[model samples]
Target: MGFDADTGRLDVTPESPAYGTKLRWSAPKLIEAANTTVRGANMRTLNVLSPAPGKAGPATAAAAPDPRPTMPVGPVHTRAPASDGYHQALAAHQATRPERHVDPTIAQAIEAQTHALRELSRRAFPDPDPDSIENTRAKRRRDAKATHAQALRRARAERAQRGSTAAGVQAPSDRRTA
Candidate 1:
């Protein structure tokens, strides 16, 4: 990822369909969205359902403004640490607006999408017990290493035994003829 200080834009290469769009992050944004749920606006649902920008019907001189879908992912901006406002107004608007929610169908769709992605991830990757050996390949590898070590030990023992015997046996020509 590259960030431009001039334009304040981020440049990121796209990932493949399956891997690129995986939602691995946990964001307070989701909670915030739930709180700021527009009364009648289903932004995401509309983005999905409507025809893409410049693909709507016939292009007209004065038709509705070119439609732009709200993308699921947006660039994030990090703020540098700054002094807090000591006199910031607390609850400047005294009127209490009760919690509002998006359309039921849109909410259901959002939840369903979340669940589906989670299911895909869970099924793709499974955690195996660390204490117990489950994979046959690992077991085979361990067995092979053990067998090789045993072979090495046997060869060394045989060499030591032969060396000891050779040393103990007196050479025929070394006998004194006194």
Candidate 2:
């Protein structure tokens, strides 16, 4: 059944009196109907005969015999084969064509440059192999750890320098007492 354009629903209705009246043909019934129609048409028929037996029965008959007389067979016309001169000319032309060759040094240099570019690209944007949420988290953790470590080292160095400077300076009270 076709769909309704306005309601966007199938044409079938459960409440209709002929809702289930329409019967669908089974596979066997559909096949039988097709065979009957083909037989009625009297077209080509299958011939299951072995030439080795030599005594094979007549071919299957058409549903309707054709009354037209068969046409007489005539000799088939074909062009003569090519002469040897044509093939020789083609070979000579192919032999006269020059072959192109690349210098080995130039080819090697090109290959090396391509490899270098690929290596630089790989280093600039390293492959994120096995990309996953855990990998991303791990990378973030490593970056944070390195940043914290650098900050800690810088703070310690500044603190050590200040401690040394403070130790060199004597209090005014201590000077007076001296």
Candidate 3:
């Protein structure tokens, strides 16, 4: 006789009495038998349909108040620290300094040129109303123009303070050839 491990089949010779006999069991009956045996042994068993130990039944447990307390509720606002190194640096940079001497004519000319350029830009790309919601591109262009004009003004002021004239006017060093 030989046994097939994969199929759980036992092969016996034709001469044996139990050679052709097949074995089977009822699943429900087997489960009931196991439960009865476990109950007799006084062992704990979990069955979803049956009442749990220490509880009257499913309905009584459902009707009883929950033992766990409710979670406390409150505002969830968060605040970041007021001061940082970047803010300190910005504050220092924005601090006013003593004014230097700059030619009024040169300053006026620079301001006039900035205004002309701003007008040209406004004509080229007409911006939407300030109150309108969708104006990101227009806003960016305006900001860029303002920043560029401010930079130009600052540069012109610095150059005038250094005794340099407007554009095309050569420096004192450049005036003398080597």
Candidate 4:
């Protein structure tokens, strides 16, 4: 008598006449039957397949509670803007000053220095040809050593003029000096 009529399922009763009927239906038919608007409409159409003879068949047990799978359902995160108030204030302050592009000659000098450093870093550590390559490498090594020594002196003088400390000293160029 206990039936979830909304889902078209009927509980088996000992006194029910159709206890041993063989049940067979496609998914579409079941869906169609469950979707009916009328209450207890066409109840006889549902087949009950169980309990061999005069015995009443036990009703289908209550469906297992649907354990809905967990889902990633949260607001997406966004990164904060990189520029802070201090940067904005500094930028605003600098904006009042006239724009000064790098001098063409100075820019060219920097580019040349960068190219030289790149070339130095690319040079093979050991001379591939002991005679010709060794001579060229020796000259390059001497030139690089002298250039580094001059840069160090210049940096030391600059730091002295500013009364700055050089506790953690670093080279002007990252490439090997020689």
Which pairs of residues clash in candidate 3, taking residues 3 or more apart in a chain or in different chains? none
Model 4: runs farther than 4 Å from truth? 1-130, 164-178
Candidate 3 vs. true structure, TM-score: 0.21
Give lDDT tens digits, candidate 3, residues 79-107.
Answer: 86567997988777778655678999999
lDDT of 3 at 3: 41
Task: Write the number of the candidate with greater TM-score, choosing between 1 and 2.
Answer: 2
User: Residue by residue across 106-138, what tens digits does model 1's lDDT show?
Assistant: 999999999999899878765555644557568
TM-score list, all predictions? 0.24, 0.29, 0.21, 0.20
RMSD of each: 26.0, 19.6, 29.1, 27.2
The true-versus-predicted C-alpha distance at residue 132 of model 2, in Å, is: 7.1
Clash tally, candidates in order: 0, 0, 0, 0
Predicted structure with the largest TM-score when compared to the true one: 2
Order the numbered candidates by lDDT, best leading. Answer: 4, 2, 3, 1
Whole-model lDDT per candidate: 0.52, 0.57, 0.57, 0.60
Candidate 4's C-alpha lDDT?
0.60
- State the lDDT of candidate 2 residue by residue for 75-169, as single tens digits: 55587678899899999999998997999999999999999999999998786676756788899999999999988887876676668769995
Q: Show model 2 residue runs off by greater than 4 Å.
A: 1-90, 142-178
TM-score of predicted structure 1: 0.24
